[model samples]
Target: MQPTELMVCTQHAPPIGGAFVVPAPPLPLVPHALKPEILMEAIALLATAVPLALVVALLCATVVCLAAICRAHRTDVVAVVQALPDLALALLRRRRP
Candidate 1:
């Protein structure tokens, strides 16, 4: 039941090679350490994404410019200004029995 008796029964002896093999402590991993394959994968992803991002940006800008042009040149501005009497006549005709 005592610690001494247990140690004696086990008969602890030196390792086979006369030295205990202990694994060296792993080197601490610094942040953002990129392995070759991981770096390559990131590069590939960026290569694919950059052009797509640029295309989307250009499309958005084109759409915005078109919308601005359409808003600035509404249908009301395209036609000649009608006379007041002609406008009243058109309204009268629209409501007559």
Candidate 2:
């Protein structure tokens, strides 16, 4: 039986002192030159939306923190109880054959 050979190919390095890991060209800059009315409407929309979004996010984060704290306490108790058998086994090991 003959072993199969695998081939790998890579891009040739740029002709220079060392290989060039050139990065992609930067994206073209966009001018945010909005019309006066469009700019005012965007500002108004964000002014109203930002506070509402913050309030909702704060409430959700608070709920998640409370739930996580509750789960942590429950897990701590479960871990202590679960460790009892291992503790007992260790204590009983001295008398084992």
Candidate 3:
């Protein structure tokens, strides 16, 4: 083997010194595979969340309306008081020592 044949001169040459450093190219802010999927998943979840929130709001509104309709007329306070449990009445009556 000859020493002249061992020499390689191309753009891909290995650097000679320990102090020599090649500056790295800038990294992308978002990863390649994850970029599109993350945005799509977030939008899908947001779409689902909006409908779920609306259903919950409608259920709360229905309950409030029903309660108002049921309480349109007042009955005797004593009759209402007697219908409650004894423990609840005791708790409401006063603070016990």
Candidate 4:
């Protein structure tokens, strides 16, 4: 084919990069049911309630953790004290070597 025909064919072909563009849809004009004042009040109540709830949860968790730690420490102390005789004998044997 002639160069002019090729040029004409290329010009008539679908434009490049056209697929990348998209037209935005029209927005609906409906008014919101929750107004700014109601939103702010709800947010304020949530802010207060969330921190209070968190503090209560933290206190409960801390109490549980402390109780667990105390129980574990007591058990460990008892075990270690019971083993004192064996530990002393081992120490004496090691010193002679």
Q: Which candidate number maximizes TM-score?
A: 1
Clash count (model 2, backbone only): 0
In model 2, what lDDT does residue 73 have?
76
Q: Candidate 1 — worst ten consecutive residues by lDDT sum?
A: 1-10
What lDDT, from 0 to 1, does candidate 4 have? 0.71
What is the per-residue lDDT of model 4 for residues 1-97, given as tens digits with 9 covering 90 to 100?
2234224332344434542223454565753537778788989999999999999999999999778667787878678779999999999999995
User: In angstroms, how far off is 90's CA in candidate 4?
Assistant: 34
**Candidate ordering by TM-score (highest first):** 1, 3, 4, 2
Give the Å shift of residue 19 in candidate 2.
58
What are the lDDT figures for the candidates, one per model? 0.67, 0.71, 0.69, 0.71
Weakest 10 consecutive residues of candidate 4 by summed lDDT: 1-10
Q: Positional deviation of 47 in candidate 2, in angstroms?
A: 0.2
> Which pairs of residues collide in candidate 3?
none
User: In candidate 2, which residue pairs get closer than 3 Å at backbone N, Cα or C atoms, i.e. clash?
Assistant: none
lDDT of 3 by residue, 17-81 (tens): 63223455568887864788888998899999999999999999999977875775556445655
The parts of candidate 1 lying over 4 Å away from their true place are: 1-32, 74-97
CA displacement after TM-score superposition, residue 34 of candidate 3 (Å) = 9.3
Worst 10 residues of 2 by lDDT: 1-10
- Candidate 3 Cα lDDT to native: 0.69
